[model samples]
Target: MQTFFIGFFGLAAVVFAVGVFRTSSMMRSALALLFSQTALGALFLAMQAEFLGVLQIMMMATEMSIMAIFMVMFMMDPGGLGGMDMSHQKRLSLLAGLGGVVLVTGIAAYTQWEGLASATEAAAADEQIRQLGRELLGRSMLVFETAGITILTAMIAATAVAVKVPEQGGSHES
Candidate 1:
């Protein structure tokens, strides 16, 4: 049933999200975050939001893949095989996380949620997605292209900054 799958994916997402924070390895943390995002996408799909589910999966897949690659390239020990401590400011982080949870819970409990969507609204949402796709590939294509180029430029700049050049008479160090 849809409810069962939604619950399953939701639980899976929460578990993987916890794994992201609990892991000591940068690579494992990135992988856990990826799994969490993918589970959230599955949750959306179980709830019948096709566009969001697919988008979440696709975007997170690419982003996390890039993040893992960067981690492997930049980290001294991305795999945590050396038993490195990856977390910092533990008390502050815990307090902040708890505060966030309390705030969100309060808001959710106090907010007025407007019931379920009707069939017509659902259809309109689907149509909106189609219109959005058209605009993205049509009038908004230039903007998207520009954004893509900007991101690529930033990535290149980061890579350049991260790279080290050897001296004329010295050897390069890993």
Candidate 2:
């Protein structure tokens, strides 16, 4: 059953990756990214890392959804089905693709070589959860709060930059 769940998660991850790469619409890409993160969280749960799994779901899934909603609200075409302005920056796109391929390959090689010996270690759920909560609040609390603040600031800045304000002066003043 565990193997089956893991395999399912792997398949879902692959599908999500394909969607991310192939979809042109920003909304579709965001959905695909969400699916991929969910699959990753499931994989963590399957490995008995319950705390990490929950954190992944809470932070990635929920947070990403909110981010996507903000993006949709601010974007010129929220649905992202409209034609895009891609007339320029072909070279930049090609360079980015090449960089992404290299990074993916590097990650694949590292994971394959490092293996998963430690990932298979088992522990009681209660203990694991306790340790995770302690570490999160004790050591990583500041980092987590800082990240939240950063996200909030970015959202505010984006909204302010995107919104257009009208002048208060009357036309007769000209």
TM-score per candidate, in order? 0.71, 0.60
Q: Write the per-residue lDDT of candidate 2 for residues 5-52, one digit (tens) a residue.
A: 999997898789778756556677788988899899999898788888
Specify the poorest-scoring 10-residue window by lDDT in model 2: 112-121
- lDDT assessment of candidate 1: 0.89
Model 2 clashes, total count: 0
- Cα lDDT, all candidates: 0.89, 0.82
Cα lDDT of candidate 2 equals: 0.82
**lDDT, candidate 1, 1-174, per-residue tens:** 987999999999999999988877999999999999999999988877788899999999999999999999999999988988867899999999999999999998988665643353354557868987998899999998999999999999989997996566545544
Off by over 4 Å in 1: 115-121, 124-128, 134-174
> Candidate 2: deviation at residue 17, Å?
3.1
